[model samples]
Target: MTPALSPAEVTINVVGALFAIPIVFGIFIKAPKLVVFGFIGILFCFSDSTWGQLETDANIYSRGVGMFYFSLLNLILMVAGVAALLKRLANPQGPQLAPPMAKYLAAFVFLLLGHVVVGLMQGIELDVILGYSGIFNVLNMMVFMYLVIMAFESEKDTQRLLLMIIALATLRAIFGAVRFFLFDGDTANPYRNFEGLDIKIFYFDINDNFVASLGAFCAAWLLTTPGVKLGWFKRGLLIAFLVLEVAAVALSFRRTSLIGLGLMFLFLFLRLPGTRKFMFSIVAAGLLAAVASVFYEHRLQFASEDDMLSSLIYDIAPSRGIKDGRFYELYAAAQSMDGNWLFGRGTWGTFSGDRERLSYHGDDFSFVHSGFGHVLLKTGIVGLLLFCGLLAAYVGFYMRHRNSLAGYARLLGDAGFAGFLFWVPTLLVGTPIIEFRTMMMLGLVLAMPFIAVGIRNYQVRAYQYDPRYAVA
Candidate 1:
């Protein structure tokens, strides 16, 4: 058995992310081509991998890298995007999504420099320059910002992105269903998980959380608007998708993601004004309660003697709450934190080169509970501060353009904010933050709605007011 990348998976990751580059660039500069690619990228994400699992130890099926993995595709896309950047030089004139944030972009650069300087002064080695992990994070951020820039190029481009996101969400839901019925939750094999590829194409591929997170993101988008494009077949698929995706989330047992998504939608339902939000909230809440009931019933049937949740519900049911059962795990993680409080060991991640010595999350682990924690582990307090500043810039810029798009813009903006805040549980979990797929997807989706703002302004000559800021 092979693992990770099937041929189609390779195409989706490579081609899909590559096209999203245009969506990013569109947010900054107008590029119709990016919209086409963005659709492709979104479609590719739906083509889950199957048949690439190889037996490592016991049930741990590991496979060689597949072509469709996001990281590998992004690398190829990066090269191509850069090459296209050359031709773009001729067009010289384009609109940017967040021109003012350029100031902050400068700030980010300065801060990175400062971190390096301080590290050197304090005799810290910057091996991140040579390490694949560090390099991946840096490049991933570039992809995030660039796609937002792509969307700013035009409103049509923004709409293109919206369509792509909606499509990806829909497809993911479909694939989730096909896999569930076809594989019977037997995600033990790659084919069982990814239904799009031949059973032979995929290697041990796992993207359960990736699917769930996006499912949440999509659900947020769909429920946010009135006329979200949903035909009966699509809507039915989405319904099925939601059920399977929610199941996947349960199966993943990704407590952090579930809690974060819950809080995010919670914020939206609470913060927004009017009946639409209110009614949607009621429906969503009721549906969620039902899902929770079923999930718990399932848990009861398969109750483990050593199950953590079971221990919490029964052993510490009265007073200890859920905290007592998992105190030791977190305490172990915190011990490492206290020792490396300041300049966290970024490269010294939980899922370092050693697979056997990893925590429950396995090889992909980063060991910092939250994304912020991951940042802390990587660059310490300094990195966290700089990273938050960059996010603030992203949020502020989106707010400025919110009115230019639909009500969905407001929802999308909140999603972006929530996505960032969503990492809080992870901070508590203190898991490794190297999950590259989530970052890329979050960047692309968040930027899509905001890029619409820039695109709208670009088309109607609204940007003409700022002659100096026009893409030159």
Candidate 2:
């Protein structure tokens, strides 16, 4: 694995990558208008920030200046790319209207707009924040997904993306494993607790676990693509790598991630026709996974995790806030919205310091992070319509195009869709109300399906009028 880059290198990357993205987007060079407008929309995500958590010494300008350069530009390039896409779509050729894909895109757009409306009700000004964030991260994810399709143009592109994903994931596993090896001794160690662990390994420290996050997600997605492409020796290497990754994630004990991974495989099976075989494979895989988990549990001497099945099964509370507070959060947010529920409380409330925790002991209001709760809080009833419709639409699209969609479409529509569908797990473990990194990841994965649709839209128009190119 490549050694982690130094801070200087990271800075160099942020600079080089930030500037090059626009050119890489190719909208200005080839398809200017679509690229330009799309970029303009994406800029909101990069707006400067004034506050954050866990700063040893806080500086308002730090947040502002940091994003001003990076996120701001990120927004610009993304919009430009989108514009380029629109320009390309002005004419292209292919089977574009797979019903499922159409529904996913349209519905998400609705949810996005609806979320902005929800914020308006509470009188918070997050329309811009959520707007920009939704546009950039979500859309960019799809770009990569479509790129998967584009890779079909060249086998090399396909290998590059897939390899990059694996390499990055492996790198993350290395970091996480080392961190665990260092910190594994403490079971209930506060330093090892989720709060501290987040600060210690990735987010708050010099070595943030940013790669670890993507690593886990990517590794989990790869689990869905299990197969035999290697000889026995190489197969042994693959087993070691999988074990390395699984160990890395297990080391973190990011339970939601586990949930995310578990559901992902489930979706892979259900979405595919080979449900029975998949189940058996998972069962076998589960045994291996179980043995690994046992080794780690013994290694750390950590207490076993609460029984998720039982709590979910019996509808019991495992922890005060952890158990069933999500249900109430969902309920309260909806109830407060009343008629406004249709369009939403407004986007601002979603990000605003609006929703306080029910705990009277000086607890603060925060996002429930349940996809459903977040929808109601951000968009109200109508937003729910869009959100629910969006999920249904994508799942439907997978049903229609799983086989027909080629190359990246297959990867993005199938695996990417499966990744987004894991939001169900997010509801229970409930991420931080403050927009955890994973939300952006989820948004990005969800966004890819739309990208495919948009690409196909252009492909069709480009070739639609060609008499000789009619669908054979």
The TM-score measured for candidate 2 stands at 0.62
Alpha-carbon runs more than 4 Å astray in model 2: 1-70, 89-156, 183-228, 267-326, 350-366, 404-414, 427-440, 443-472
Candidate 2 overall Cα lDDT vs. reference? Answer: 0.45
Worst-scoring 10-residue span by lDDT in model 2: 43-52
Candidate RMSDs in Å, in order, are 8.3, 8.6
Q: How much is 248 displaced in model 2, in angstroms?
A: 2.1
lDDT of candidate 2 over 1-472, digit per residue (tens): 1234567856875686567666656645463434433332232112121122322232211221233432434454454546545644875674343334445455555666555555566565553546432332333433433332332322233334445545655655565556556754323233335333332322221111223333344444444444413467755555567666555444434445555555655565554446445554665378437734643453222433544343332322445443254455555655566566566555444332223545421243435546566656655666566556756766665565455554444554554565564555664445422332334445445544554444444445546878475322
Candidate 1 residue runs with Cα over 4 Å from true position:
1-71, 80-93, 99-135, 186-253, 300-342, 346-366, 399-404, 407-432, 459-472
Residue 256 lDDT (model 2): 56
Q: Local error of candidate 2 at 264, Å?
A: 3.0
Per-candidate Cα lDDT values, in order, are 0.50, 0.45
Clashes per prediction? 54, 39
